[model samples]
Structures are given as C-alpha cells and as structure tokens.
Target chain A: MLLFLLAAAVAVAASLAVVLGRNPMHSVLLLIVSFAALAALYIGLDAPFAAVVQIIIYAGAIMVLFLFVVMLLNAHREDEGTGGAALGGRPLAAGAALAIVLAAELAWAVLRTRRAGGSWMGAGPESDGTALQSVRTLGGVLYSEYSLAFEVTSLLIIVAMVGAVVLARRES
Target chain B: MSSVSTIGQALNGIVPVMCVTLAGIACMLAEAFRRRGERMPIGGLGLVGLAGAGASAVLLWGRRAGCLGVAEADDFGLFVQLVLVGIGVLTIVFSSDAVEREGLPAGEYYALTMFALAGMMLMAVATDLLVIFLALEVFSLALYAMTGLRRRVYASAEGAFKYFILGGFSSAFFLYGVAFAFGLSGSTHLDRLAAHVQAHAPAGGLLLLVAMGLLLAGFAFKVAAVPFHMWTPDAYESAPTVVTGFMSTAVKAAAFAAFIRVFLHALGPLRADWLPVVWVLAICTMILGSVVGVVQVNLKRMLAYSSIAHGGYLLVALASGDEVGRAAILFYLVVYAVTNVGAFAVIALLDSREAPMQTLDDYRGLWHRSPFMSGMLAVFLLSLGGFPPFAGFVAKWYVFTAAVRADQYALAIVGVLTSVVSVFFYLRIIVMMYMTDKAAEAAPAALPRVPKPAAAALWLSVAALLYLGVLPTRVVEIAARAVASVL
Candidate 1:
C-alpha cells in the first residue's frame, strides 16, 4: 500500500507538471518522470517485464525522439511559452475532481470485496501470473503462431526506412 | 492438408505477395546499380513482378491456403490481389514520363511503388488483425513518402505532412480498438474474434461497441468516406498524378477487401448494432461527395470527390450485405480501377512543369491540339460520368440494383441521384475538350507530349473498361463465384 501510494503520488505530480509547465522541454522532462513512475508501479504490481519495457521503450527510445523533435522545432529558444496560460486552470480542477471520484470508486470496490470476503485471491496451486514466464510464452507464441505478423513488421520497418530517405534526402 | 508443414503452408499462401516483394527489392537494387541518366527499364521490372503476382493469384484461385492460420489465399483475396496488380502495372506503365519529367529519383519512386503494391497485396490476404495493421503501416508509410517525393514542391510536403499526422492518429485509434478487442476476446485473429464475439453476443459489451466504432472510423478515413475525409482532397490533389491514380484505386481496393472481411465475416453477428451507423455514413458520403465535388475546379480534387462518392456506393453494397452486393463490389472495383487510373493518366499527360494544366481553363482547346489524347480523355470522362455503353454505367447499375434488391431503397435512390449530379462535373471536362470554342482564346497550356507508355496504358485501360462494360457477364459470374467462396 505504501509503495502504491508513493508511485501514485509521483505519477500524478509528474503528469500534472507535464500539462501545466510553461516550457516544452520541461513538459517533456515531466512526461519522462511520469513514465518512470508508471514503470515503478508496474514493478510493484509484479509485472517487472512490463516495467522494464516501459523504461526501455517509452522512457528511453520514445523520449529520445520527443527530445529530438523538441530541439528541432525549438532550436532557437531554450525555454518558450508553448503551452502557456491560454489553457486555463478550469480543466485541471475538473480533472482533479474526476480523479478523486475514480479513487473513491476504487476504494468502494475494495471495501465491498473485503466485506464479501472470499478467497478469490487465495494462495492456491494455480499459476500466479508470473511475468517472466508470460514474457517467454509471448515470445514463443509470437515466433510460432504469429510469425506472419512478426515478419510483416519487418516489412513495415523497411517501408518506414525508405520513406524517411525519400522525405529527407538531399538532392545532388 | 493435415500433412502439410507450416513452412510449406506459408509458402503456398504467400506466393503472390512474395513475387511482388521480390520485384520491389530488385527495383531498389537496379536503382542503386544504374549510373546517372541510365534508362534501365525499372518500371518494366515492376510490371514483370506485378504480372507474376497476377499469374500466381490466378493459379491460387479456388485453392484457399492459410499462412500459419494468419493470411489466407482465398479466392476473394486473390480477386482483390488481381485488381491491385492490375492497378500497379498500369500505374507503373504511366509513371515513367512523370518520373522523368519531374527529375525525381527513379529508384526510390519505383521501389516505393512496388513496395506499396506488395503491402496492398498483404492487406488483402491477411486474416489476422495484427497482420492487417502491419500491412496498413507498410502501405501508408510508402504512400506518404510517394506523396512527398517532389521534395521541393510545397504542396507535396504539406499534403504528406497532413496525411502522415492524420494517418498516425487514425492508426492509434485502430490499435486501441485492437487492444480492446484482444482484451475482450482472447485473440486478434479474425476467426477467433468471430468465435469470441459469437460466444458473448446479444448482450454485447460496451467495450466491443467501442472497438467496432474505432475500427470503422479507421476504415472510413482510409476509404475517404465523409466526415473522416478531410485529408483526401488535398492529398489527392498534391500527389503526383500517377501516384494519385495508384493510391486512389489500389489503396481503396485493398482497404475495402480488409473491411469486408472484418465487418462482414468476423463481426457479422453484430450487424444489428453497426448497420445503422454504416447507413448514415453512406448517406453522408454520397451527399457530401457529390455536393462538394460540383464546386471543385482542379481536376484532381474533383476526381477525389468522385472517388469518395464511389466509395459510398461500395459502402451501400456493404450495408446490403447480400450476395449481389458482394459481387457488385468486386465488379465495381474492377471498373473503378480501370476508369480512374485511365483518367489520371490523361491528367498526367496534360501536366507539365511549366504548366500544371490542372485548372479547367487549361483543358480548353485540348482536342484541337491532340485529337487522340483528347478522345481518350473524353472516353474516360464519359465512362466516369456513367454514360451508357461505358463501364461506370454498368458498375453503378449493378451496385444500385443490388442495393435495391436488398431493400436499400434510400441508398439506391441517393446513389443514383448523386451519380446523375456527378455527371455534370464529368461532362464539364468533356465539354472543355469537345467544345473547341475557347481552344484558341484560352491559356496556351503546354501539355506534355504524349509519352508512348502512357498512351499504351490509356489504350489498355480503355479496352478493359469497354470489355467490362459490354460483356459484364463472364467477369460478373467469376466475381460472384469468388465472393461466394468466402461467404
């Protein structure tokens, strides 16, 4: 519960900073922090595989692309008022209210389940949804059952590469 | 079949696509090897690949094979594959002069076109939603670059940028829908999705409805159906004329093929929930396409609207969801591909760097200068306008009749009325060509000298359109049988 609370707090704060920040670079940094916090939450939930992927992909690769686009778009200015105050604070208030309602609903569900106290989450002989094992099975199924989609993804990448060259290459 | 290994099964199912893909790779290599200004027949190489794929598709007809249970080489897919190959070949045939005239990089252009065709083939055959999405990305990426190939042209870059942004957003919506569907049902394969949906139905889940809505929105954007069609006119108008032709015909064919398989075959049991939505979409597409089309002066934008209206007619057939509707769709695709590609090829010839010749005023006196080209353009325009003894008339007649037979009277009446309304624009072009009144006084637009390959493509398309229009019986039966196999 403590870990969940810490991760939730960090995620909420970082995401709020992402939207409310005056500078695009600051927003990007806050978005990265939010992703990192989400990854930590995933790890806390026993999904270390997803947590690692979230770090490697979202926080690493996609963030790098975002940084590149930001720099390319705003090379002349270090900090500009891109997401300025025209986006009023009203939406944030409504958003906070919705978030509180969602949290309250979650608490209600948990309390109701506790009152009805069953062994639905009982420690039993069944698999406990091991993340590592699930990832391995996913790999196996992707290679065997979904090899078609896997191969075609390679084709998509090639097309993307060709497209990048076509769009960006300098003529002699 | 039981004894067949997975590799062999995949090999059997993917032969047609493999042919085209191999050709794409070859074109890339050929482009790399050629010296500057070396006129190696790169486009010819593309045609050979498309023809090989076409031959393989014909051989695969009536012999459905599943590629690892993901892609299917069914007659329906093969039929669409044949149409895409035809579109690819004709586009390549008409592309050389445009490529040369623009001083564009030949290798990239031909290679990208071949890759786009290969992707379209994959989309037609893919039975898994995952594979379909990949195919969608493959073609979308290639076409985006193809649209922006003229890097210096501002409109080209602008169009590609708008298309890419919107295309990426729509793809996200589609991916979200797929994720939701996989969560609701345990698989992304259409066959498995059908089973799961069947198991959960009449008490349909909200999540499922949301999934269908997202998926339909993605397809509607792709087919340029109204409300989601904001990108079509600019993209079509700005793309090189040959690329526009190929994109409009081949892209729409592949998209409709996948759309039919998903909505009609997989989510068919949920038709009650989705039919009214499609009905409204059809009505809007027909009304808006025709209404907005009448005001366009640029030929490409006008054709773009016309294509949107044609897409509505196909959606009308889709809404019908009957045997005749299925056959009508196949027939209409063939006719539409031939006529639209031919029309765009004429546009290509009339276009030059010094003079784009896109405006209606530029077409005046075209007949006096080049009788043959003007005659060909007139034929295409007449065909597009749905004149009797032309392919468009037969296609529209088939579609509306099928729609009416399925009790889609409103769709039929609307479709016919729009077709009549659309005739004005088509005739406007023909009148520009045939009037000869303003031939001397109009702008001295320098039409590109008729390239041999383009003329050949025009003749061939004209022949195909006439064949389909006059003798619709043989092809109609064949289309019926092919679609029946899937059902």
Candidate 2:
C-alpha cells in the first residue's frame, strides 16, 4: 500500500508538471517522468507486461509524437516568444513538482523492497510463475496466430510514411 | 504442424487482403517514377486492386476457416470485405475528378485508399483484441494523413490535427479496455474471452461493463455516433470529397463489422448490462444528428450529420438483440454505402477550387445547368430521406422491424420520427436543386465538368439503389446469410 501511494504521488506530481510547464521542451521531459512513474505503479500492481508496454509504447512511442512536433516547432522558436516575466513563477512550481516526484520515487523504492523481502531485480510480491510467461506467450501468439497482423503493421507503417511524404511535399 | 491440405484453404483467406496490399505498394512505386507532366492512371491501379480483392472475397465465401486463430474467414468478414471493395471502387472512380481538379497527388491518394481498405478488411476479419487495435490504428493513421491532403487549406490541416489527437485518444481507450479484458480473462482472443465471460458472469460485472463502455466509445468515435461524433463534420467538410465518401461509409462499415463481432459475439452474455447504455446512445444520436443536420448549410457537413444518424439507426439494430437486427446491419451497410457514395460523387463532380459549390445555396437551380447530375442528385437525396422505391426506405424499414422484434418500441418510434424529421433536411437540398430559381446565387462557372468514370459510377450507384429497393430480396438474402456463420 505504501509503495502504491508513493508511486501514485510521483505519477500525479509529474503529470501536473507536464501540463504546467511553460516550455514545450520541459513539458515533454516531464511527461516522460510521469510515464515512468505510471509504469512503476503498474509493476507494483503485478502487471509487468503492462508496465513494459507503458514504458515502450506510451513513453517511447508517444514521446516520439511530442518530440517530432517539438522539433518542428523548434524551427520557429526564435520567432515565437516565450512566456513573459509576468509568468516568472514557473521554475518554483516546476522545482516543487520535481522535488515531490523525487521524494516519492525514493519512498517507493524503499517500500517495494520491504514488502517482497527482495531487491528491485526480484519478482514483484504478487507475481508468480506466469508473470514472466506473459511476454513469452504474447510473443508466441504474435508470431503464430497473428503473424499476418505483424506483417501488416509494417505495411501500415509504410503507408503512413508515404502519406506523410505526400502531405508534406511542398514543391512540384 | 497443420496439414498441407488445410493450408491451401487458409491461404485463400489471406488472398483478398494480399491483393489490396500489393496493389497499394505498386501505386507508391509508380508515383516515385512518374514525371510531372505525365498523366498516369493511378486510380485505375487502385480499382484493379479492389476488383481483385472482390473476386477473392467471392471465392472465399462461406469458407468458415480461422487463420491461425487470429482471424475468421467466415461469411461475415467476406460480406463486409465485398462492401468495402465496392466502396473503394466507387471512391476511386469519384476521385478521378477530385484528383485532376484539386491537383491531388494521384499515386499517394490511390495508395492511401488501398492501404486504408486493407486495414479495414483486416479489422473485419480479426478475432483478437490486439489485432483489432492494430488494424484500427492502421486505417486511422492513413485516414488522418488523407484528411490533411489538402495542404493549402488551413481548415484541412486543423481538421486533420483534431482527428489525429482524438483518434489517438480513442485508440488508447480501446487498448486500455483490451488490457482490462486480458487482465480479467487472461487471454486476448475474443473466443477465449467470450467463454470466460459466459462462464463467470455475476462476478466482476462492473469491470466488464467499464471495459464494454471503453470499447464502445472507441467504435462510436469511429462510426461518428453522437457525443463521440464531434470530429465528423469538420473532418468531412475539409477532406477531399471522394475521401469523405470513402471514410464515411467504409470506416463505419469496417468498424461496425468489428463492433458486432465483439459486442454481439464476445460480450453476448452481458447484453443485459450493455444494452440500455447503447439504447440511450442510439436514441440521442438519431435525435441530435437529424436536428442539427437540418441547420447545416454546407453540403459535406450536412451529409456528415446524415451519416451520423444512419450510424444511430445501425446502433438501434444492434441494441435490438435478435437475428433480424443482425441481418439488418448488413443490409443497411450495403444500401447506405451505395446511396451515400453516389450523393458525395455528385458533390465532387460539381466542385472546383474557384467555385467550390459546397453550400446548399450553391446547389440551387442545378437542374437547369446539368439535368443529368441534378436528376441523379435528386434520386440520392430522396433515397437518403428514406423515400419508398429507394434503398434507404428499405434499409430503415428493416432496422425498425428489428427494433420492434426485440420489443424496443421506443427506439423504433424515435427512429421513424427522426427519419421523417431527417427528410426535412434531405429535402432542403432537393428544394435548392430542382425547385429554387437559377439566378439566386449563380456562380460564374455553372457546373464543374464531370469526368467519364465518375459519371459512370454515379449512374451505377443510382442503378444499385433502385435495384436494392425494387428487389431487395436477393441482397437481403445475402445479408442474412452473411450473419449466420458468426452468430
């Protein structure tokens, strides 16, 4: 329960920082922190597959979503002005948020080890034999029953690439 | 490990989707080589792909094979595949004009349509939650890109951005729901989930209900149903006309096919809980779509709402738990697909960059300028209004009959009343076209020239609407037969 509370607090604080940050760059960075906290929460809840997906897809893939847009926006960063001096309290808010997240992350680590009588590398308290098997079964099914779907995902990505090129092509 | 004899049959199941995917790659490669001045028949390449897919679907009909336990090559998927192919063919035909007039990149447009169609087909056949979500993203990404294909139009860019974000949000909900379902049942396959749900109901009911709601929200957004339908009009209005037609029909058809597969099959045991929620959704969608559609002056935006109401009618069929309701969905999909595509084709033919005749006023006195197209438009509009001797009338009748059979009298009553109210909006276009005077808001160029292929497609749709209306028995039989293997 204490582990849950700590991870939850970190997640909520980091998520708040993500929305409250004035700079898009800062917001993107904070979003990653929030996602990582959520993944830890999932691991605490004994859903390791979901935790891995949370890190890989939600954090990794979605970060690409924001990062690409931020890069696009970076080209016009000099043209667009930042929040003025009237909005100067951002760092105080950001620092408070990060401090809360750091404190909770440390608390979670302490609480998690206490429960499992194990270190961070140990299997989570509630997890048994099947937790590790979930990823293997997922892979087995993905290759055997859903290999066509896997192949199609590649095609779908190619189509997305073609579409992006077509839509963004400015010259004749 | 399976025998080679069974392998041959399972391979047949993948053939249709393979045809479409290969053709899409061809179009992409062709686009890279073609010179600027060269006029390539890129749309023709897409048509060939759609035709090949259609033929393969016919060959695979009633096969009832499962491809590696991930997809079912049943009558249900094949029937929907044919409908998608038809929609793809018509959209390509209609796109010929839009491609030339709008200076749309032909190779990109045709390739994207084929890819989207392939995704829709994949969605229809997929029997697993993860595959469905991936298939959902496949088409969603392509359509999002197509939505912004109008690069110069700022609103198009805005619509695409809004669609992308909302679509991504909905997919997340869908994925989370799938995760919950897997968490609950320890399996991602619908058959396994269904067996688990059936065996252990009255326990963890609330969690199941929440999962169902999440899944429904994702599909409702795809089908453009009420409350979840905020993005429909903007996206439809700003997209290229042919694309709007393709998505408004094919996306909904594909999504509905998957929706039926999940709700009516996997969650069949939980109907007592999910039905009332979907019932309320159906009634609100029908009411709101028709009433707001009446107020829209823009043709594309108006049709967007009309399509929303049509989705509600299909939802009503879904809410009514009976074989008739199941059959009604297939029939409605076909008739609705034909009429809506035809209607949008007329709008596409009459539009150009300078004089984009998008408004209701723009259609005024259209009969005087192009009698052929005006008459065609009249037929499509009348069909949309549920006029008899038109396919929409037959489609709406079957939907209401299913609702009545399930004792959903209130939904049936509301459906009939809203369809009548919807006629007011449909006639609003008719009044502008044949009834209103010529000079009210005449543009400098009276009618945008209709290309030969698009004109042929419109006439073919008119014929289809008439055929389905006059002798719906054959098509109705096919629709009925399509639902039998799955349910």
Top-scoring candidate (DockQ):
1
TM-score of chain B of each: 0.97, 0.97
Error of 2 at B234 (Å): 1.0
Q: Whole-model Cα lDDT per candidate?
A: 0.87, 0.87
Model 2 chain B is weakest, by summed lDDT over 10 consecutive residues, at B439-448
Predicted complex 1: CAPRI docking category: medium
Query: lDDT tens digits, residues B1-487, model 2?
Result: 5688787666666678889988998998898899878988988888888889999889888777667678887999999999999999999888887887887788888898989999999898889998888888889999999999988788999999899899999999898889889888988899999998999774647788788889988888898888899999989998988899889999989999999999999998888888888998999999999999999999999999999999999999999868889999999999999998888888888888777789988787878888998899899999999998999999999999999999999999999999999999899888887888885543457567787877887888998999999999898888888898788
How many residue pairs in model 1 have overlapping backbones? 0
Q: Per-residue lDDT tens digits of candidate 2, residues A36-96?
A: 9989987777787999999989899989898889877783232234444355888769978
Looking at candidate 1, what is the lDDT of residue A147? Answer: 88
TM per candidate comes to 0.84, 0.84
Model 1 regions lying over 4 Å from their true place? A1-48, A51-56, A63-67, A70-131, B1-6, B438-446
